[model samples]
Target chain A: MKYSKQEYLDYVDKKSPDSPIWKNVLIAFLVGGAICTIGQGFSEFYKNVVGLSEENVKTAVPITMVFLGALFTGLDLYNKLAKHAGAGTLVPITGFANAIVSPAMEFKREGWVLGLAAKMFTIAGPVLVYGINSSIIVGLIYYLIQKL
Target chain B: MNKKLGKQTIRFANGINILSYASIAGQKEGEGPLAKYYDKVLEDAEWGEDTWEKTESKMQKSAVSRAVEKAEIDIKDIEYLFAGDLLNQCISSTFGLRDFGVPFLGVYGACSTMAETLGLASSMIDGGFANTAVAVTSSHFCTAERQYRFPLEYGGQRPPTAQWTVTGSGSMVLTRQGNGPYITHFTAGKIIDAGVADANNMGAAMAPAAADTLATHFRDTEKIPQDYDLILTGDLGKVGKSIAIDLLAEEGFDMSENYNDCGCMVFDIDKQDMHAGGSGCGCGAITLCGYIMDMFRAEKIKNLLFVGTGALLSPTSTMQGESIPCVAHAIAISAKGE
Candidate 1:
């Protein structure tokens, strides 16, 4: 009895257990909201206590968050948190910091140059590339519209 | 003296015995249900090594030494050694066993390496090519994770189908001489692709191959599932095991009884938070060497069918959207050589 590719896929899909989408969404929402709240707290601290300008406060908040992310990754706690948090940790700027620091730390055994520096951007490199290119295209369209 | 049985099965005319076996497990595995069965469980994943790859090599080294020591044979007496691991270029096996100075043959059947090595080693002994040989395989959780998935500290969620790779190693000493629990038949499996492209869902990718090999083994040996006291597949976990059972049932073989998977047995799935169950080359190797061997020695199981299953897909292949190609190899071991 031979099963075609589609038949086999359908059978596997039916047999295999699916992830709990509703539960995951709920967790991700709560945790992601909590992280954003923390970021807001940092923004308030920088603006009021530190007496920083609006733009500088925005920059300081993200830097602090990235720092916390890298520190947690180094302490080996972010992955543990992200395990249950799911997209909660990933949707934040902290996730980007983890994406960079993790490979760097993991491959550090190879060497400082080839291992840590070269592979640091493996995950986040694509995000940067596409993000910057898309922004430039948008800026060019805005400039053309203004000229017209 | 034709040893060929059916299309894929080989009947050993001369007795091929498992003289001794050993298992070394990691901390997580040590905390599992089969903890007491393992020869030694390391508290550290690194095993005092600088890297995870080195730790895996150390595990293979320890496993082989323990097996050889239990067999009461010197390393020099062993004519051939078969070993492998789930590392690129099989560096763990090569680096681990290099110091022994034995005739080494490195094999790669993905996670099915244990069965592949055993089948080859036993065949070598039965064919009079070697009087004594050893089969060993190892897999490290960290090493496998870094190579196959993401970095250790990378924050990502695994789906329900993802299996935790077992951090362990197992080795078996096979010789032409022993009293019982001899390898009677070997059935090599074909590469079966069931169009599963998800690397995380390894059980689904490998189930069809396992089912095909098991069915072929039964057909070639002309033995029913009732003939064996136990039928075990390597690292099918919960998902693949059920799929395999259903596939076999469709082919008129009822595997609802006497059929379990090493993946499910090696770890306490519910308690350990191992989504699907244990996987990797070590999953089958340790289960067979540690728990199942004790069962054999105690005469609890007279007949056993061990099938090692493997999903042959690399990260590159998965990235290319290619389906996983899987294989399974079955070896029939009987206490009375029946």
Candidate 2:
């Protein structure tokens, strides 16, 4: 009843905070690249020294990284790392593990079944639901293409 | 002043006085800009409590007790206490002040609870119902997140739209006669839903209600934004702040010069990693009780409009895909004898 919507929009545009693009991008890149390099190192060790098949190495690398991530999260060290590393810590598989364990640990006070078990998946729940759904759709499409 | 302005606005004839107030914050909030303004800052979020919930209760208790102490009043002299929080059953307030032995009024306006308590407490003082009243509210980041969003340890990434719940508490002592900011008028808000369903974007959900209340206040009082030295909305972080600014402009009040959102102003968004900004009952309560009240006392600000906005949605409601219903209450405060 006072001013027009256009006028309000302009005010908002002027007031929003500007992100530090160069700094964020540089950190994200360095952190993301570093995580990938570590993952690659694990893969190389599994492939050459462990004498594992390529398929087995592919699975082992992520599993190892995820285990480390979850372990750091359990120790409450991952959050501190994320705080300083910014998106660097978030770019790796460790971030996913941290995400799952953080909320679960936060809710442990409400009891095991309702608190921990239920909330353990709060953030990851949507990701899993959509991941599975889309995978099913992709698998069906692959099947159709193969048949054709 | 006219006691009643319109359907929702009320003006106090005998201006209710703010005798004293206190603010207490957890570690994160203590690191913010208004850090120096608070009465106490907890070294840890738990404040020596066993659970985060209990910690929040202790925060509320400390805030009120400190305010009462600052006001130089005994607990028994306080006629009533008004308090609330973002907890189920309002347990934070109930248990926090159970030992105070003051007649209590539990309010739940989500983040807007600070304004709600002040508005109601002011009315009671103006109506001569009580000689002295205390208004307090609190919120803890760990407890609110666990109750409304997810578990504390959940490493789930918060989107930029998500706001950090402020871990703090604020309390105010209002008396029939005192020297401080005067509770001049207030415009009660309506529950407004712009059909926003995303719980993560609380600011966006609560903006419409804030806009509605501000416009109503302006209309009822026949006043413009320039009438007040400052105009603030509670916890409409960066995102909601923008929305409210635009809405107020549309209502023909250009507040760009003197307006700010408590949520956005409390934290350094880029440096603090506070995504959008701060949200919670404590965000508004601490800002008003600590920052704004100090301004009034020092004569830095003469008159101001503080609109406390809230998103009334439980985790259950949001989980059921229900839209967030929001409300904002606007109270006009002026420097004493103004």
Candidate 3:
């Protein structure tokens, strides 16, 4: 290491205390808490207000979470929040939102170049890759079952 | 008194044509601070290329075409055309010159295309390869966004290192005639990447590049801040511009007075609502074409230093966890009475 542990610590201590770390943590709390509260509210709605099955609501939760993330991400509010919070706004379902929105946002600025064109797939890229692969496997299993 | 032994060399712009420049962005119909959004300008323009491209080409053609008209020289009168843009293929500039009907030589220099292209054209002229040429470049938020940002349709988060796209273009006609404009000096730049930054804010992303170019220009020309009528930097914005001045000052160069940043000068900082004001290659180019031309034509300012800055990162680089690498080029444009 270039600097000793004590030296590194001293350097960091002298560094500005106003780093994004604390704000990022707060963003995690605020966004995470908000999402969690929404989950609880959804569960309650299914359990009491809607009389829906728990399994069904559980399945629907991720979709709603993604939708909320997308909406906030679209409004430019989420991005501004993201600037201050960094990964805090990005780690959860918001990450999925960011994945989709970020690429599109970049491309939107690009016009129709490969950057923008490629961005269309950026946000949902992982979901499609994993989901398609799993579905293909599931379909093969179903086909074998029918043949057997 | 000592005079340098270097011989004079001049290049002319030739075979330059404007094929057609088209793109759009920004808010559609609103006046005020919110319109300061780079995307809003593109969205408002409601076309393809970002504000930087649209603004740059329009201004470029506006002046160049006029100069063409003033000199009574047809587009074909230009033998070598030197041009560039803040784009991947230099499309904004290539397409900008598409309709003018002349040969095109693509040039690339972040924001210093005006000077960079002029330097090239002058070399060609001095070499007797061409007689007249036009050096042009255009920048737009829409085109730049796609190249540097996200698709116009997709929403993305930007780091502070990213800068708002500018909306303008600039072009100049370089001729063999002594009565026309000429490039007085040229200084190349070195790539500088200081790793402490967020990628979304371009001013920070390009600060090091600006510093390097500015420092080199002063050193190479042996000129101080007060030597030029105006010392301008291309698209440094508020943050990068300040950093450039500070960095130069560290080396005993105080450029606050005779120095100006293109990003800071174009739009009203108070009214434009841009966090850092104007930017992109178009920022300086348009200012030069629109205002600087008038000043130069009238012989108001002489021995001006124009430094253009650029961040050399593609979107792929950022997505791949690469930090931004930046470069800048400086050109000195002057009109000494012949």
When 1 and 3 are scored with TM-score, the better candidate is 1
Report the C-alpha lDDT of model 2 over B1-338, residue by residue, as the tens digit: 45788779998876789899999988888889999999998999777877988999999999999999998889999999999999999999999999999999999999999999999999988888999999999999988877776555444446567899999999999998876578888799999877777787788778889999998899898999999999999999988988887777877889789999989978888899899999999999899988888888788999999999999999889889998899999989988534
CAPRI accuracy category, model 2 = acceptable
Candidate 2 Cα outliers beyond 4 Å, as residue runs: A1-37, A50-63, A77-96, A112-114, A123-148
A63-105 in candidate 3: lDDT tens per residue?
7778877787777567666655556566667656666766766
Q: RMSD, each candidate, Å?
A: 0.8, 3.8, 7.9
Proportion of native contacts found in each model? 0.81, 0.30, 0.16
How do the predictions measure up, each by TM-score?
Answer: 0.99, 0.85, 0.70
Q: What tens-digit string does per-residue lDDT give for candidate 1 at A1-148?
A: 3788999999999988999989888999998899899999999999899999999997899999999999999999999989988999999999999999999998998899999999899888999999999999999999999999
Summing lDDT over every window of 10 consecutive residues in candidate 1 chain A, give the lowest-scoring window.
Answer: A1-10
Q: Residues B294-322, candidate 1, lDDT per residue (tens digit)?
A: 99999999899999999999989998999
| Angstrom error at residue B237, model 3 | 3.0
Model with the higher DockQ, candidate 1 or 3: 1
Per-residue lDDT of model 3, residues B83-111, tens digit only? 88777777766766778778889987776
Q: Measured against the native two-chain assembly using Cα atoms, what DockQ does each of the candidate structures obtain, in the order listed?
A: 0.85, 0.27, 0.17
Highest TM-score against the true fold, candidate: 1
